[model samples]
Structures are given as C-alpha cells and as structure tokens.
Target: MKAEILYEAISEINPKYIEEADMRVITKINPWKRFLVAAACLILCISLSIPALAATDNSFAYELLYTVSPELAQNLKPVRETCEDDGIKMEVVAASIEGDTVNILLAMQDMTGNRITASSDLMDSYSIHMPYDQTACCQLEKYDSETGIALWSITIDQAESKLKPGDKITFSVSEILSQKEHTEIKLDSIDVSNIIEATEFTVDPQIRGGAGNFDEDSMECKRLLLPEENGYKLCDGVILTGTGMVDGKLHIQCKYDDILNTDNHGYIYLKNSSGEVDEYYSSISFWADNKTDSYEEYIFDIPYDELAEFEIWGEFWTCNNAPIQGEWQVTFAISE
Candidate 1:
C-alpha cells in the first residue's frame, strides 16, 4: 500500500513537469478565435532564416579572397598550400602608363601553360608586382640601384611557422599607396596557394657568368653579358657582375683537373654611380682575380650593384683549356 501510494504521487509530479504544448493542441488552437498565434510563428521563422543567409554570404566572400594575391608578399608569391591542395597562381606583368607610372596585374596563363588561353584579364590595376615571400616578414630585398649593398632581413614571427612538404599556406597582401609611398591605394588581396617545393639557384660564379665578349679580346670579364642559358659550366674564362655595398665573397666551384693542373690570377673592379671607374665603389673593390686553376674553389668578394658593373679577371693566361665540369658550383653571400 505504501509503495503504491508513492508511485501514484510520482506520476502526478512528472505530469506537472511536462511541457504544456503537444502536436494535437497546436492543430486545435481554436482557429475561429485566432489571436497572436500566427504573428508569433511568423517572427520565429524570420529569426531562424537570418543566420542561415549570413553564413552563406560569409562563405562566398572567403572563397573570392583566397583567389587573390596579397600585394604585401612582394613577388608573384601567392599564399600557396601545396601539401593538401594545389596552388592558385597569377602572373604579374608591367604595363607602361605614363613616364614613371606602370600598371601591374593579376593574370592567368597565356603563352606558357595552355594553348588556347589568351591574355587573361583577371585583374589590371594601378599597381606593381612587388614579388615577395609569402612567409611573414619575408621582405624581398630589391637590389639598391645606387649602393652595392643588400643588407636586408625579415624576422618571421612565431605564428608563421616553419613549413613542411604538402602543407597549406595562406598569403595575405595589403595596399601600397604608390611608388611614392603613401601616394595612392594599390592592392588588398589575399592569395591562397600551396607550394609543392621551392626551386633554388646556388650560383656558380666562374662558369655561371656570361661568356664574356672578351673570349679573345681582353682580360677583364665583360659586364652583364647575359644570363647563362646553359647554367654554370666551365669555359675558357668568365665575366659577370657582383652585388653589395661592400665587397662580398664570391665562390666558384669546379671539378679539379688532376693531370697537368692549371693556374691563372685576376682582379675585379667596379663602375660607380657617377659613371667613374673605381677600385672601391662602396668600400668593396670592383674586383677581379683571375689565375690558372690551382685546385678549384669558389668566391672572391667584391663591391658591386646594378648601377656599377664588374670587370674581374685573372692573369691573362690560359690553363688546361678545357671546360671545368663535374659538381662544381658557386656561392655568393654577404659578409658585412
């Protein structure tokens, strides 16, 4: 009797706690005496629909932003994510506007990738391609026209991390007022992409330089002969330019001729911004040190910039007049 009484009491309490609304009651809400029921229902429906619409809008905007290149990461560098996804790319070219003015664009593949694609008008604006590293703080140091110095550095924060293979990387670029800093709005795009790998050029100074027009003419290597089409290769001699405000080391790597061996000595020089030839353009010698191949090494520091060219040479003599081949390579880096 006691247990039965407790069970009856619990049933009455559970009913009281139940929500008062049910499906049958909703259908029989006394339609003839309709009150504020329909209005309340309409308001509830609107509230729920708004968030759905906003979510869709946000999704579309993010998609568009990912296709764009950030102007900040100077260079055609898009925020590439190659590990999981292929990269979205844009080619930037220069278009002369007026005197010192130029127009930069975000373009699609024209003569390179596909056969039918024409000059894509993806985006053309009053901008310049500031090719930069998408990695944060990675500023591309444009060579100083006047100084032979390339003392540029960027400190990537902890947030932007070291990359691994097949990782997705996002790049964000912002506006540059103008060439005359703060002149006009330039760009504000965030390019999304991934890099499968990076291609590097570890210069081989000796064989990498232009086949100087000095083949049979003079001692000093010619200035700006042309970018080597065949990459670094041993030749009769070499002619090329160096970079820096002060003399930096230049390394020439070549296969050591074992038989008779070879020897020649030379020096490098520079032409200053004033168009005057100088031994030291920017505290660095416009230098040349040509000599017969003793063993085979790389690097002879010199001061040079775009404005000033280099004409370095070894003793106007020839050694084992054969091409320096093998895994010979060159390396040029700043010391100061």
Candidate 2:
C-alpha cells in the first residue's frame, strides 16, 4: 500500500519485447481495440485507491505488471484464475499486499448440487505456499445458500519484511468438512456404583500431553487404566477405553481413532440421576496408540459412595468421517 512498496513491485517489470510465433496474426489487432483495452485498464488502476470502488470489487495489477514495463503493465488487462474439481469450482476473486501481510479472497461454488453450505470448513486442511517463510490461516467470510457459493479469506504474514509485490503465492485445500454434528452419549452399562479400585496400573507412554490438578510429571504419577476388556463404544471412531477408581479419584479414559484427520473427539463426565452434570471435572489428553489415535482421561474427586447416584455422560463431535477430498489450488501474485 506504500509508494515505496509499489515501486519495488513494479521495478521487476521488463520493458523489452521479443518477436514470437504468429507475429503477423498478433499485429492484426485494430488500434481502436487496443485503445479501448488500455483505457479500461487505466480506469481500473485509477479506481484502485478509491475506497468506494474497491468496496464493490477490484483486481490489483502488481503481478500482471511484473513482466512488462510499468507503463504497459499499468494498462494491461487482468485475468481471473480458477480451478475446478469434483463438481466444484474455485476462483481467486481478489488479493492485496500490505507491508508484511498478504490477504486473499477466494470463492467456491458447487457446480452440480446444493452441497456448499455456511457450515463448511477447511478443517486445517488448507495450505498457503509463498517464496518466503510465513504463517497462514483462513476462515469462511460469507456464504450464499441460494447460489451454493462460499467466500473465504486467507491471511499470510511473515515475521520480517519478506513479502514482495511479484512473489507468487499458491493456496490449496485438500479436504472440506460440512454438516457438523454434536451429540451427548449416556453410558448406562457402566455400573459406577459397583466400580472398584484397581490393584495394578500402567504408565501409558501413549500420554502425549494433558492438564489438570493431576501432576502427570511428578507425585507417583497417578496411573492409567489397563485395557482389561473391550470397552464401551461411545460413538463411531470413539471408544470408552476403561473406567476405574485410582487413588480415591475416578479416572475415565476414552480412545479416538484418526483424530488428526477425522477430528472425532469428546469429553467424559458424570450426570446425576436428575440429569444434571457436575461442572467440577478435569481432563488430560494423550496419544492412545500413535499420532492418529488419541486418548483423553477425565478425573473426578467425588466420593466412592456417591458414585452410584451419578451416571457417566459424554459429549462428542463426530463428522461422520465424511470429508470431501480433492485438489483445489490457485496461484497468483499480490497487488496493491
């Protein structure tokens, strides 16, 4: 947005021209046609700094001018970049660069059906690649249910002033999730009233990380439950590994498969016979098997005699393991 930045961006343009194939065909362009195109580009560039004009929609010429003289590039017409896959179309609508940040606007539309929704998410499956080291994040900006179109905003920032005007940036998404589902599960099979303290416990190396009053790093390491039997299935891709009383505390462990991809996860707690959940509970999470499979253990300080009046309850988010997978990529340069 600064004049120095624009100068640096336009300085990369090469003014020289070389003869190419079909030169005669290219020279056939009428002077009037060329004049009209140039006039249109001049109007567009002049409106670039107009807030009202940009509020509606506009394209920056920073990338387009990188290959020609500043004068020619300033008058050159802009082209829209788009890609389609699996009945879906993705278009790079607008982009801009400000100091150490690059902002991009993208639009996606379902071509054959009304599958695109306001709840759709990239689910951390999107990537932005730049010539320099940077951090990128995206969020849904808007959605039109009637048109099956969704607009997303992506921001890429660098720790230092590494972003340049003509730098090529590629944005891609590999997976998309829609129709979020959240449910509460009741564990009626587990007789909390008859729960007994375990004699032996294992120091589960699968413990990735956790938080709570339970000092996992010290204090004799209050033990993890042993895989005694096939545990209760809380939901799809989620299992209640085991439950036991450990050192006067109730420990409830649950396993989730392919958490990185599916994001199938939940929290475990207890509800009274009147179906009221006690808010005083803490949890620690770890890798049950590997990075793909995760485990979370909830601990409660309730007395053993009072356990019977409480029932185990779980609240989970399941995407039905349904993700639309395809390659959607757009490459363009940031402009003022």
Candidate 3:
C-alpha cells in the first residue's frame, strides 16, 4: 500500500483530512485505489468521531493562510515573538495587517538541535522595520523545510506613511542563512522531455501605476527553457517577464535563472479554452532581482475579460525539495 504509504496511513487517520485534502486528489490516486479509499476513510473516521470533525470545521488557520494572501486570510492575529542569536531560534508566529500589506508567520529553530534550512538565500537577511519606516519589502510566502517554517509578506509602499493599526511592527532577523547539511537525493525519473519552448501573448489594458494601478498595456514577453535534468540544474533560464492588470487582478511575471532557493517551491497552471483547469486561483509574488536570482509574480484573481486562450505550466523546486523536472510552458491570447 504505497501511495507514500497510503499517504502515511491517511496522515495517521485524518490529520485534518490529510491536511485539508485535494493535493490534486492525492496525486491522482491508484495506489491500490488509494489504499481502498484510505481504508474507507479510516473506517469512516473511526465511526465518525475524528474529534467531532476537528470540532466543526477549523480550516487549519484558513488552510495556512491560504498559502499566502487569500486576502491575508481574514483577521488573523496571533503573535508571540522570540529570539536567540547564533544557533538560531527566531519566531514571530503570526500577524496580519491588510491595506499596505504585512503578513508574517515565521519560525526558525536549530538552537543546537540541528536540522535547519530556511534559506531563500537567507531572504535578503529579512526585515520589516517601522521605527520610522523604510525597509518593508519582504516576500517569500511559504517555506517549510520540514518545519523550520516561514510565510512572510511585507509590502509597505508608503503612501504618505501608511501602516497603522496599532503599528509597532519590527520583525528583523539580521541574518539567517542556514544549512546543517542534509543530503538525500533519490530519483528514478525526471525527464521533462526537453524542458519547454513555445510562447504567445497579447493583452492590452492600461491605467498605469496610480489610482489603483491597472496596467497591462499589451503584455508580451516570454522565455522559458530550463532543464538540465538528471545532472540537476533547475534554473538558468525562465523568463516570462511581464503582464499586469490590477484591480481585477492577473499579474504574471516570471524571471529566474538563480537565487530562488526552494521551500517556496513552485508550480503554476491555468488551462482554458474549454479544457477548464484553474487550480486554486493562483497566488505568488516574490521579488528580488537586480538582474536575476528572484522573480515570481503569479497572482491571478482572474478577470481580464475572462482570459480567452490559456495554458500555463509549472516546475520549480530544488535546493533539497527536489522536483526540478520540467517542460514549463506558456500560451496566452486576448486582444480582440
């Protein structure tokens, strides 16, 4: 019974519905029919009592803050700062602050227990100041090297000093850059044919940067041909460069040739033209690239006259999470 051991025995019989179900329906079942439908849903969740269905729908903190910004997962506020130098230990647990954006949910440890790795190249050494502003532009929506934990988001565009709601935010980490050295690489296959190459784009909607920024003025930019598989090399090419349409949302940028350490992993999809496949509304918006090393601007709230012809693809995960196999794609058209 191996679908990863029947998903670890359905995560030990209903770990919050195997952590909120739908992992593409558990990787398209068929491990002995998903272990007889996970042993008949673990014998009907042990004759219906899984803690009374986790005490009536708790959505695991909005499914982990909806993987970042499902509108900042409504009214969240649970903080308990902690710190410790050198051997690392930091924590910020939770936070939220809509408007000028600011969502945090950090956690790090190694206090000598050893087993660390949360480096997206140390995420620019982290920051979120407010002793008088200037330094809020962090974004690494999720990382969990088996639980060192991370989910940051800070965007204070300073529209005349904004960030009020009992403001006292100061989540600085000065330096992290961890790695106690752990290596485990196992792969039987990951061809991805020949990476990918085929592009198209057309869209023009504009309003430029102000008054709510609704720009798309004919988005066109594409380039993605990364794949040095087997010998492993997940980046050294990936560029879709532009596309934006605020307010009604649908941004697409994608530039990465390096410096996008994993744990925020990556995978994008959106197939339409009647094939209908719009995985979870999309959401990712990292940044840090003065010329390579970071660029992920997904974020599709959908609504660009309903996007006509679509076909996006995915693949990105290295730096230990491994899964760099890819034929990442692209296709788009909407210029009636």
Candidate 4:
C-alpha cells in the first residue's frame, strides 16, 4: 500500500519537474510528493546499495521513482535484473506497455574500461522472446559518456490485443560493436582525381536497397576490380573497389565483404576545401553474393574539373570482425 501511494505521488510529479530533474533540481512538487520521493529514494538506496544521496540533488530521484511506478519506469530506472559479461553490464532500465505496443529500454555499460562508446551498437544479433506473437525492433537511443552507459530502445508490437501489464519479455543480445572509425580514402594505385568516364566497367549486381535519384528499373551497378588485387583497404572488412566518372556524375564504388555477419558498411562523401560535406548525392547497394559480398555505389553530382578540390571521405565500421560476443539476456515485466 505504501508502494502504491509512493507510485501515485511520483506519478503526479509535473513532467516539467521530471525534465529539470536531470539537472539535479527538485522544485515545485508539493510537500507530500516530495516526501514520497525522498522515502522512495531511501528504499532504493538500501535495495540498490547506493553509497550516498544529496538532498538537493534529485537526479537520482527520477530513477528511484521508477522503481515504485510502473508506467514511469518505462523511461528510466536501474532494474532489479541485470547480466554482466566480459566486463560489460546489461540491464533492463525500463519497460512499459502503451496500447498494444510494449517498449523496453536496455542499458549496456562498460565497467572495466572505455570499450563502450557513443557509437556502440548491437550487431543485429539480438533476439526478443515473448509468449505472444509480436514484431520487435531494437535501436540505440543514446549514450551517456559520464556514466559509461549506452541505452537501447526496443519496441514490440503484438499481433493480437493480448498484451497486458505485468507480462514478461526476454531480450537477448549475442554481440556488441564499438570503436566506429571514420577516415579519408587514400589510394596508392588508383588516382580518383584522374579517373576517366568508364560506363563500360559496370556490372549488374543483385539490388538490395538504395537512396537518392537511382531508378529501380535501371539498376546502375558499377563494376570494379576485385578487392584482393586492385582494391584499397579503407577499413576492416570494407574496401574501395572502383572510382570513375560515369557519364556526368562521379561514381565511387566500395565492396563490403561478409556483410551479413560483420555488418560492415559505410557512407561515402565528398568534402570540399572548407571541410564541408556535399549533401547532394545518391547511393545504391547491391550484393555480389546473397549474404557474403555486398557492394555500394555513391554517385556525386560534380564536374570532373572540381573533383580536385574535393576529398573522398568514408565512415565505416567492421563491428562484427572484432565483436564482444556474449549471451546477455534479461527478463522484465512491462507495466501499462
């Protein structure tokens, strides 16, 4: 009964106060609400073994309130359940249900070192297990450098209207990727600036997905030399295959080997003299083989004469090549 009142009082806290609480300010809440918040914090301090708490600092209060309030818990809290492996900790910070959709927030923290960065992402190797049939997607919401924590949001949509409060769901991840690097494409053999028009050097690869003005009917897959020979090593698992002026546009092609496993892919951009990226560009992706070899073509709308003023830049990740593989799973109940 006390937990219920504490939950209600915390729930009544102004949303604005909750936002300001991030800055460690506790204000405008009534005396009773403030007392409940303090009492909840005391309980959590004992339950979670918190070392200390500042009376004026309410940043921790928000998390404490989540323990008592289920609906509010979906946003932030240190859940009771956690799995730690390979010097990394995975915890279900929050879980709640809205209508037929269930949203779960999971946090991954690197305790031993700084391996978990802002770019740390799941390698499409995670799975969600629930009793009901549902479709779920997991995405990295944000990372806090101060606490060495990265939060991921998982949204699950039930097929039928069968989901309710207090239903348990299991979230699991097999691998995590970090240390994403971005670098300039420098070739020892291929001179990108002097590449002439070579529309004949194009090959038709299996289309996967694309962006920009590329037509689906006219799939323009630019063929390039094999990475084993003429390819320039851009990063781990990614290679620069070809560069040429196809028609009036500049075509930069890259090969992603073992794409399905590594999640090794990147963005190609042209940077000008002022270090500003050219936003107007189109790209298409295709598979040399179904799951093993993937190729991406970046088409830039610029004249060959101006190509000398621009440098090729790429943001790539070979995440799966050196992934932190572990079985991190957590079962948490959602509240409506």
lDDT of 3 by residue, 162-263 (tens): 555544544444433343122222111222222222233322212112111223332222221121222223343444455445445555545454443432
Candidate 3, residue 268: Cα displacement in angstroms equals 20
For candidate 2, write residues 36-56 as lDDT tens digits. 243443333332211222233
- TM-score, predicted candidate 3 vs. hidden true structure: 0.23
lDDT of 4 by residue, 1-336 (tens): 664344334433433343355422211222112222434433332222111222224334334434434344333323446889889988776556656656666678899998888777676667665444576556555577787777665666567546666555556677887875444464445555687776455355567877667676663544432223468777777778877776678887788878666667667777777989784367777777545778888888898888888777776655544678887777666665
Which number leads on TM-score? 4
User: Which parts of model 4 are misplaced by more than 4 Å?
Assistant: 1-79, 83-89, 97-103, 109-119, 129-169, 178-193, 199-203, 214-216, 222-228, 289-291, 303-309, 324-326
TM-score of 4: 0.58
Per-model lDDT: 0.22, 0.61, 0.39, 0.61
Q: Candidate 1, which ten residues in sequence have the lowest lDDT sum?
A: 327-336
**lDDT by residue for model 1 (1-336), tens:** 674344334323222132132101101122111222334332221221011211433332222222232221222122111111112222221111111211112222112222112211111111111111221122212222232111111222122222222222121222111111001111111111211121222222243222212231222222212222333322343222222111233322222222122222222333334545433211111111242322222233442233224332221122333222111111111010
In model 3, the runs with Cα more than 4 Å from the true position are: 1-88, 91-109, 117-135, 138-158, 162-167, 170-318, 322-336
Candidate 1: residue 177 lDDT (0-100)? 11
* Cα lDDT for residue 144, candidate 3: 56
Count the clashes in each prediction. Answer: 57, 0, 1, 0
Give the residue spans of candidate 2 off by over 4 A: 1-80, 95-103, 131-133, 155-166, 184-204, 207-222, 227-229, 245-250, 268-292, 298-315
RMSD of 1: 31.7
Judge candidate 2 against the unseen true structure and give its global Cα lDDT, from 0 to 1: 0.61
Candidate 4 residue pairs in backbone clash:
none
